[model samples]
Target: MASTKKTTAAKVQAPIDNRETFVSLQKSFADSDMPVEEKLKTLYQLQAADSEIDKIIQLRGELPAEVAALEEEIADLKERSAAISAVIDQLNRNIADAKLAIAEHESIIEKYQRQLETISNSREYDSLNKEIENQELLRQIGEKTINDTRMEISSKKSELEDLKDRLSIRTEDLAAKKTELENIVEETAKEEAVLRERREECAAKIDARTMSAYERIRASVHNRLAVVGIYNGDSCGGCFNTITPQRRVEIVSNKKLIICEHCGRIIINPDFAQ
Candidate 1:
């Protein structure tokens, strides 16, 4: 009597509204009658697609980080520039106050001198002279303070100019870098999206158990290679380990999954790799 068992073709529905559910896709592949070789081939395709995505990500290396750093630096520069401007303003105010003090001292000296001319007593005359001397000293001190403040303002202005020049150059650099990063991201975004869709499609066709195994191996491996082909008809493609005649024949037959003993990578015939 012939076997009554029936094999059902694998049916994987595309994502609804462009939204994919990994659980549903996994269950679909798990319940399907997809052949083991077909599953391995699908895994290989997925790996290739994912590897391309990896390359795309690598191409964008450090650009985002650089953009962030430039932004932070520009912000810090602007803050420092503002602080310097504030200092300059305060120095100018101080200079103005010093000038006012000098004027007040000069008026006091003039008043004391006029009082000295009117004093008849020697004691009163001496007191007026001392008052005039004190006022003159205060005027000299105020003048010195104004001069120091002006020199400081001049120095601050020079520093502010240097900062402005530096800030301008950095701003220009940041703009160029931002544009460059945006262009690269824009170009790769479409390509990556297509590759991702292809990967998901391939994943949906693979058996759940096989997909789980492949993912496990991929995660464990440093280079993310879980599926590899025969190399030179006698060696494993992943680790370059020599394969025995029997094992090589089994791998070529593709009747079942074959793992490399040395590297634990899933081995496929070289023909299937194409």
Candidate 2:
């Protein structure tokens, strides 16, 4: 293993430019004494380890993602259920207040009617009748408020029930998916753990800029191969594109780091794969 350096590339290059540095990442470690072939070996080893881990992850067959989605849905439903509960509680309070207002209005109306019977003058009788009429209007308004609030509460409760039902289904789904995932993980756990450890060890040998470039390439490609050997003796292994004769000679020389111009994957000489 080579001593890893955290130095940046050339002063002209960004500290870590995945796009441009990918072509000639060796410049990022201009001061390193390790040969290019040795660096490519470490990078290839890292790719192998990652590929193995990817296969292990495939064994789970989307169970992990399903579990994650279910959990997210359950969380959202719980939040909505809580909000609906709060709204229902508020509406109940409104109904309670409306009922109280209706009771007060009824009492006032009763008192005004009694006063109307004892009034001796026409002016007094008119005033008592006016007070009674005002009280009746207020009572009707309070009853209408109570009716509207109850209807709203009923709607909110129905929404809450739907949310609860959905939450229950999602919770069950998450549990089942989690169990399946746990079983798959249990089977591959040992192999995956060892491969991951090897991957870290191999990655540590390479310089920072090369590692950054390799990671970016892996993420962009479907196969996740960032370092590949010469394919069928004269093609880019990653994309199967024909390599120029002159470039293939340089790649075989291994004096300088080489990459495929078409696919941008680091090209290791086929001889090295031996």
Candidate 3:
């Protein structure tokens, strides 16, 4: 009758050690079906795969900035090239205008020379000669303007060519980097698939309540571990914190669910005495 009362109290608090429930929950996990060592192997494989996928995603995100920088540099180079081309085009137009002016001035000089040969008075002759000299001066100025424009056009073309070359090289480098990232993702696709499948299987087997507790604690902790094993002298394997004498006795008695006070982890006390 006393044992019956204790059992009734436990049932009122919560179902403790329902063998059927435990077996059902354990069966739910594909990992539980495997041997202890094999379960560890599967867990580790899943963890490693998750870690690799995270690293790959991080690496891919990092590459975008590098690629964007390169693209920006290339765009700047192209803008510079366009600006230089505009300058070159303006210079060429100026050169053409200067040549036209020079030709017109030369025609005026030739006409003045003909008129000077037939002038009747010295004053008129001197005026014609002065007009011819002005035309000659104008023609010389036009020639100098044409030469300067030609030099500017040549310099701009050279600078534009150099910018184009640099831009091409940078674009090629960006393409190569992008290709490398794509290849890495593609090569790891198989492993990623395996990890995802195993994670699904693990999720289905774990009880909702248990998973909720595990996730809550795992999210709060740095180690991401929610379960811990009790070792010698009732110490946690994870944190190595000693359990109190009373708690140890309670845990050994298997009266109810036990948690570590120091780490707040759900403890799985192995029946070491057996």
Q: What is the TM-score of each candidate against the true structure?
A: 0.73, 0.59, 0.62
Arranged by TM-score, best first: 1, 3, 2
- RMSD (Cα, Å) of model 1: 11.7
Candidate with more favorable, higher lDDT: 1 or 3: 1
Global lDDT scores for all candidate models: 0.77, 0.79, 0.65
**Residue runs of model 1 more than 4 Å from their true location after superposition:** 1-39, 229-256, 260-263, 269-274
Q: Point to the candidate with the largest TM-score.
A: 1
Prediction 2 global C-alpha lDDT: 0.79
Distance from true location, Cα of 136 in model 1, Å:
1.7
Colliding pairs, model 2: none
For model 3, how does the per-residue alpha-carbon lDDT over 1-274 read when each residue is reduced to its tens digit?
Answer: 1112332221111122455644454444333444443443333343444445555566666667777888888889888889998888889889889999999999999998888888899999998888888999999999999888888888888898899899889989989877876776787677667767776675555446545555665554444445555678669754677888887776656434455656655455455322
Candidate 2 lDDT tens digits, 136-157: 9989999998888888999998
The digit string of per-residue lDDT tens for model 1 on 51-151 reads: 88877886677677788998998899899999999999999999889898899999988888888788899998988888888889999999899889899
Error of 2 at 53 (Å): 1.7
Question: Once model 1 is optimally superposed onto the true structure by TM-score, how far is the C-alpha of residue 246 displaced, in angstroms?
Answer: 6.6
| For model 3, the run of ten residues with the poorest summed lDDT | 7-16
Best by lDDT: 2
